[model samples]
Target: MLNFERLQILQKYYDYIQKKTGVRDYFLVGGALRDILLGIKEKLDDVDLTIAGEPIGLYAQMEKEAFSHFITEKFGTITLIPKEGVMQGIKYEITPFREESGYQDVRHPDDIRWTNSLLADAKRRDFRINAMYYRFLNIKKPVYEEKKVLDSTTLLKVLDREGFVFLENSGVLIVQNSSLIDQLLQNGQMDSDFLYYLLDIQHFAYCYGEEGEKTDSDGRFDLQIVIDPEYGIHSLINRKLETVGDPDIRFQEDALRLLRGLRFVNVINQKLLNNENKEQNADPLNKVRLFDFETETWKSIKKNHDLLKTIAKERIYQEIVKSFSEGNPFGLVALVDEAEMLPILFPALAKTKGYDQPIRYHPFDIYAHIILTLWHLQQINSNYLVRFAMLYHDVGKVGQYEQYGLNLTREEIRNILAGPLNHRFSSAELMKEDFRNLGFSNKEIEEIKRYINEHHTPGEILMGNSQNWTKRLRKLFSEVGYEKLQNLLDINIADRLGMYNPLQNSSDLTDSYYLKTLVDEIEQTEGQFKKSDLAITGADVMEHFDLKPGKLIGELLQVGFDWVLGDVKHRNVKKQILANIANYLKQKK
Candidate 1:
């Protein structure tokens, strides 16, 4: 059951609609109903409803009353929002019952025909568990006698007692068999009058099956009871999930669902495992089952793997974002690999799988190391940029390693390792195409590239002697802002943790203590190394030197700026800095 407060809110809307437009045949549908049946008490902020009649007319009437509403005639849907009522700012999407056809694109339907039948609309849904409805009904007004003289009362006498007593009752009523309500009412020993009232309405909460057959059992149970041991909705949800229609056809129609289904399975399995430790003899119905595709679904995914390539990158990106948002994105990524969808979705990532790495430092191969790095990122930070940076950080290694030969000179190896020709820059270059395809903004793409190119700089700085550490640190800080520097440091740490071996002493390449300490120092200084931190601006330089706003002033200012970085005390000595700049300019002249 939904929270009583939510039901009250739904009732309020139902009443408003009926009072304004005289329409009462509205059915609450989709995930809102599913959540209610699952006994979830969270707010059903996005309410989906199906109206038996014209939703556009209702929208128009709602608009006249100063309510906010919008209609999409393509799908025969209307979004009604109350501008000032109790539901203010809450969106309620009301669509006329619809039946669709011609799914040629395997996504949107080519034809949508509105219908008045709820069962027909229910049958058009994607999953049986999600194909359910809740009809809000007003309780019949109570009849009462004011005085004890009703036995011999005439019509006129009954009219005289009309002012004696008034009775009003309102609650949500669902359609179901009397026996079920009888069981609940009897079990709870509810009032006889309430039972009579429920019997009078003859509606109970029930879920629809794939074929639109109304069943007393919860639809979620039908799909999940096999893998989940508990009896209630939570168990039904927590257990393995299966599809309603042919799995292959479903995958072929919407390829994004394939990835989304896998993500659901990964998330649910993790939840189930967690629940097992916390719960004893847990009811399957009480378990929280997300979406789970069937075994055939997995098989269908493999068979129709090429179909994923045709799906929009935006759709694929949304699924990836959702999976990464979960606690165990690694599991989802693994499932994608197992299903062979990785090659279609992310070929670069797939290519990393078999690439070998130096075993002394990297316990796993290139691909395994990337996954481990991602896992470490999840533990340390939730920033998507950092996570994505780590994902493509070493993709260039695959191409770089292939160019290696035993006859290479020491100088050539040193140049390859230290120069822009290395994998870091190469990986950044390769990631541009993929990131653009994934709909990342140019700015975001640039940030990822910068992070990838500079991810190794922290370690490089740590390897340097203390005499040059400040200069290197200042240069690094000036290049990347404070926040991005922190992200780079996180990636560096994840990189080290990714290469750590449990059996052996930790590798120096993986050490992060010094890097963390440097981060602390940088934060304490608050980016004072940046050129912008110079006390004298370009304007000041121009004024003091009696020069125009030209490049020479910038060059002169840079000399002063370097002096400040070289010694912190020089920052406060503006007069001495200006005199030094003058002496240098005179020599240049």
Candidate 2:
């Protein structure tokens, strides 16, 4: 529980309620106490406060205060999230203290009875870690520290001192009673939603606190504690952090537990070498494989873009927008395993080569390379959400539409392996349709679409460059849009990593690492056409030469763009560019 932020917001809201309607002793139950001990923070976007013995007008005060971007009401409990910034839409729900009876749904109690006891309200939470509570008289001013351990420092130290403290390390404070966990697991309670999400859907489980609550025995007060890995809370915090705080909540929450899995793995490998620990952690666990971004895009396509159908387009758009602006997309793509999603992503290709890569060039062979690329991607930046644009980019290669392959023997043979020239183009269209489905706004789709199309354009430019690396990069940036230049490199990296021969037209260029020399060499110097150093734009060339902004001007820009890429000094006046274009066009003219 990140009690400070959680309670602070609740306290502020309660104080506000007191000021407006004179509501006192409002009950703040669930997750608030858990977050405080778990080293988490609260979001002021929406404040949820469970009013004691009342199910009305929780928002009379909020309606009077900073409520521009918000809408308020009381169905049973009051929910208010600050309607400022991206988090403006996030909701903070305040419910009246209530005891639940009879399970009509998997996670919700069918009947509700308003209660005055703190334990009754807290018992409704899914896990023990999420079931703690604190109550205050009003929201205007709060005594936050009372009976509340409001920071992670105290609990973290103790948990760290106790190694193999898996439950504590989870950052969720578990209650001693087991009944809460058991009840939530049963159908008809709202907790079943979380149970299904973590257990059936995601296949992860809660590390329940082993002890029991001595004071409250029907297990009504008992709760299991575990970190909420779902992005909702993180997303809520992420939307608000930009306004006043840093964006990383996990770092402040409990960085120890944040990378605990990675840390454990590292220690295991180290100790296995030195035999430091008595019991060996390894038991020859089979390596798991997942889809790379490209493969997942194909699978998503087969699923008919069903993933983001439930979330708002704006939310998806914002995430995509942030991904492009703040994160590494290629690396994110590497996490997706195309193999697992074959039938869905590129059923067309899966039937032909069986979605297999040409093994002679790849070490892990085709299936393994996809997984390898995702692994390599994880080693880089794990923060950014890779775009579906890039994810669907190479999916066309997976499906082997018999008609696509070109063979001299017969039309049937040619049709056997090669696809139409528009294979990737069709894939792009599918991607565009799913852009919003994948959580992108329409405005974001345009940029992403261009990025996808042009990802391969740079490789084509390099091929046409007669082996000019610097020229290739310049052409890539200018023509493709310079924003995702590094993204292009990441895509190239994934492509090379997933193949035996990603470079040459033939199998001759099989070794993936061999390109490191060339790629590094490209990185060591400047790219071909940096925006600051550019000699001329299409408009400039057309206006200067008294030329129409037609095919002629287009040709001139391409020629001039290439020229400037080869020589940095061409970034000067338009005279040299016009002169060169004159001569080049005169010869063709």
Candidate 3:
């Protein structure tokens, strides 16, 4: 199912190479081919080309013809930059068949050897589905249909003459023999009228791999797609992530493949969800379902989970982010826990696993509550920072209870742990160190720290009956800015919903809505909120106190702002602000 426009561009390049070198030994390989087989409609921009023989002669000729190319001689690969025609802004990395060995560092190969067989090259790849190859052939485009044909009797008669059958119920076409379609196309037995109906059938490609070969003649009748030496198409049709050969050997060769396997599961499940939501009328045979790891693959991943420690923290961080950001995040966490990689990744968060909370506030233990909180954030499409903050917001409770349990009864401890505490500040402190280890930027670390520290402020403001809410909120807005306050409110709502208690609907939900509406109303107004909005400046403080520009000047101004924060009318009166600063200086002296 190659895109018609992309197929034309590929055909042009194929023809150009065939004419230049007088040989046709190249094929399209890797992710581009995989995406085509999966019926993904996104534009296929990056493509890879592989040849069975040497690529130097072709690379030299293309370089001489003024094509921009970069070559890595040792790896036997060349990246060609096509800057003109239909292939503009596309890169084609052409590589000769090669085998790798000796992965001592667990990331790169120590040696590479050239081979002349496509099957040999396929055996050394990561997964079965990515080992296939595709070639563009010279033929007319096959007929394709987006809607069902009403005249099924005439179409079935034509297909029956060609030894094929059309299943009207599922809209799938099946060949009487596995090789019958290939033989007919090769021997020219398929007439134009018959070929039109043959290619136009929906989900016709599902019947392709059973006979040990797969073909895609959609955009090109001579489309010899999927040289699947490892039965990649079968694995794909079964919705399984399988290694090329021995799962253990593959994991031993590259430890990163374990996380990659998990990520593929996440990515495929996301695709399935997207299809269910967006493609209701899609053919059943073509719909992707929930993907899972083959039994052997899952076992190998668990057995080799320790190899992840050898990987760089940055790499592990990237894989974790990719796994959780786009797909079923709860599934990602559960899989990571099942593989026993959670303790190694985040030990502090892992310590909260068995720590139970009071049933009145949380039906689940601390760890499950954290996971549910993360899922709630996911339902609202929160960014990764907020999700990560929620994942560890309550982790400090473990240490908090342990340190204070010496003096309290069991019931008293549970009641104490059921509510928010200074543990949030402790969690923020611990998170800073973890962020430093995981290579988070300084700005990112500070933002997450604020999220953890201020997550409970909105709940306090909304649930409490206080007359100074305007002052507290305006001061909070001044301290962290407006955007961060808004995000903290989101975290508050998610945290409350993650709890399982009677007050969730009455106090929690109503309070959250009230807080949101209050903020929105305040945002719509043009009232002054912070020290910067005051009429008195730092210069006023320095001049009135006979002080130079230093920390004292800023401190005096802050004191002045605090004095007027209780009443908005006092903010614009410079005389009163200076008088307040004078009183603050007298008290300090």
Worst 10 residues of 1 by lDDT: 221-230
lDDT: which candidate is best? 3
> TM-score for every candidate vs. truth?
0.72, 0.52, 0.74
lDDT values of the candidates? 0.61, 0.41, 0.67
Name the regions of candidate 2 deviating beyond 4 angstroms. 1-48, 53-55, 61-63, 66-92, 97-131, 134-354, 363-368, 382-390, 404-426, 455-467, 480-483, 500-550
1-589: candidate 3 lDDT, tens digit per residue: 2122233334455655555444455767776666555655355566687776566765765532434678888777887766566666666678877788999988667898876666567778898778866554434443334334323344434444545543332223334332543443332123344445554653432221112212335533344333456655556566788999999989888898888888878866776677567865888776546678999999999999999878877887787777667677777888889999888777778888989886767878889988887877777754777777887788887878675757988776666556544577778887887767766778888888889988878867875666767767777776876677777777887888788566445234765766667666666663437666888888777777778889888787788777777666545599988887787778878
* lDDT for model 2: 0.41
lDDT of 2 by residue, 344-421 (tens): 323332332335544555544333454444344434424233344445554444443322344446665454424443
Q: Tell me the lDDT of model 2 at 541.
A: 76
Order of quality (lDDT): 3, 1, 2
TM accuracy, model 1: 0.72
Residue 420 error, candidate 2, Å: 5.3
RMSD of candidate 1 to true structure, Å: 11.8
Worst 10 residues of 2 by lDDT: 238-247
